[model samples]
Target: MSASTTLWTDRPLLGFDTETTGTNVAADRIVTVALVHSVGPGRENETVATWLIDPEMDIPEPAQRVHGISTEHARAHGMKAAEALDEVAEMIADALRQDIPLVAFNISFDLAILENELTRLGLPTLTQRLGHDIAPVLDGLVLDRGVDRYRKGKRTLTDVLAHYGLEQDGRLHTADVDVSATLDVLRALTAKFPTLGTSSLEDLHREQMGWHRRWAEGMNEWLTKKGKTPDVNTVWPL
Candidate 1:
């Protein structure tokens, strides 16, 4: 569809997320992953797929507490890391190939971790599989920040839901629940910012790249001012 004629709400969206062993995308492992595909208004046409992976590593107490997935449970029921990662990449690659936007609250983290896992497993990264970097991604977090630059307070998934007056019916941090909430927040964002809904997915994706770069630059400057290392990467999608 042409950039000016597209209506984002009318197209399919694939919301993805991962619950990992820790926050370090370079070294951490995914304990669980989820993809929620939805279409039409209010996301009435929806399908969800999820995976629990045996990260084959210790799940830190703090991370386990956040997602409520203990190492014991994962060891007992989760699939091998390589198997799960392969499936996850295939699902995401399929969606991207179809021109559907992959929705995530903070996409860079999940995509980075997935890429690392794929490399570690000797599998083709999503970019390699698709013959290009993944595109037409919709980041609810970036879009919210871009549209509400002056808002005061944290923009965590829960915080964003509360800001948009949406209820979270299930616990946060679980991959599937987080994906569902992310989709709702995206819907609310588009409603609040009509331009976001009307713009083509490619245009929205490019806009978010700029927004993320600007945000990261400002944050890095603040860290430097405080004599702290600037750790934020200015790249989008890792």
Candidate 2:
């Protein structure tokens, strides 16, 4: 467990993401998991660990369109959602306790979803084990929105990859592939914005939290103007 004081390039970061039955993190059951741990820096990088769990819930076709995991495929080979959820939650907490940061595209959503699942199962949520609000989280999405406030196109993982001139090695929907692509996005963003590159991971986390709130507010207002519900701002621990 490295402390948050560790240098931006020195800290170990565990990047997490989950594929679920749907987009409502609070209500959804996780169907797939992916984590990529990077230790050390640049050319000396050590990237390891990847897991794909069978989320026992019937993965809906609409959800499958996002991540390509079908109910039939998941049911045929997916691990029990409860079991996978436990392992995922514990691994994330262990990483955080050890001082390793967690990076997710939209960390708030994933962390909140995982917290809900853990609580339902009588396990400790990441916030509980961490004894603090979820900080030290690096969100590529938030960083991108902050750095390029008016980027022209979609801000999705794939869209951002193309925007940065980076190529994703694996298919988009798979967890590990998305994680790796996300890491690439972060590296590229930091490279382009030297200010972000030099900031310690802790500072990056602080900055991202502010950015997330602002972006969420703006997005919500835009949704209201269009006569739709602003759904992304739900209470995190729900």
Candidate 3:
């Protein structure tokens, strides 16, 4: 690759995250979402778009506690689910069409949830808009696990931000906050591991697929040994 060609680290990155009614991708509704666009190494180079949606369903107390968005708040202040879903999905597709890598903590969950929302609303899923599979995603969590296999601690967004000596940008679990924080963590990850910053997005995307599967298979083995259900999704970007 030519040095003049922008790497994923330096080129435009679209950071994504969602606050949902629950963890059930197929069944839950997307209550909020953030798509952060970064064209440089700093937050000053970023433009963020966020949305709160009335999911047209109850937001359970547990989910409410995590994202602080109650069904009542959504009903009163949020946009209609279908309208917000259409706008959000198109923006994401537009970004991807321009070859911007979507950066997120655990991208599969957010990407899957967004796709499901679009499908549930009878709108075009991102894949349908892009005319191909989603590609060139940069998942900070998957890459972090691959590079530091022996680190013993939680890999939550909070844990990762601290682990990388990156100060907390803001409160997490909120859609916009988590999205920007994930981008910061990825910047730190690439700085610490130079190869990650230098590799082409296509190569990095392919490597992450293998990385996520290996992590999942190993986690499944450990869970099996403990006689517990293996709950990790082994797929990349769903």
Q: Against the true structure, whose lDDT is highest? A: 1
Whole-model lDDT per candidate: 0.90, 0.75, 0.89
Order of all candidates by TM-score, from best down to worst? 1, 3, 2
Q: Which stretches of candidate 3 lie over 4 Å from their true place?
A: 1-3
Model 1: residues >4 Å from true position, as ranges? 1-6, 41-44
Instruction: Between candidates 2 and 3, name the one with more favorable lDDT.
Output: 3
Query: For model 1, how does the per-residue alpha-carbon lDDT over 148-207 read when each residue is reduced to its tens digit?
Result: 998999999989999999998789998988998898898899889888888878888889
Model 3: per-residue lDDT, tens digit, 1-238?
6658756687788999999999998899999989998988777898999999999999999999999999999999999989998998888888888888888998898889888888888999989999888987989899999888889999999999989988866778988889888989998998889899888888899999999999999999999999999988888978
Consecutive 10-residue window with the lowest summed lDDT within model 3: 1-10
TM-score of each: 0.96, 0.86, 0.95
lDDT of 2 at 3: 70
TM-score of 1: 0.96
List ranges where model 2 is wrong by over 4 Å: 1-7, 40-54, 231-238
Clashes found in each candidate (C-alpha, N, C closer than 3 A): 0, 3, 0
Question: What is the RMSD, in Å, between candidate 2 and the native fold over all Cα?
Answer: 3.3
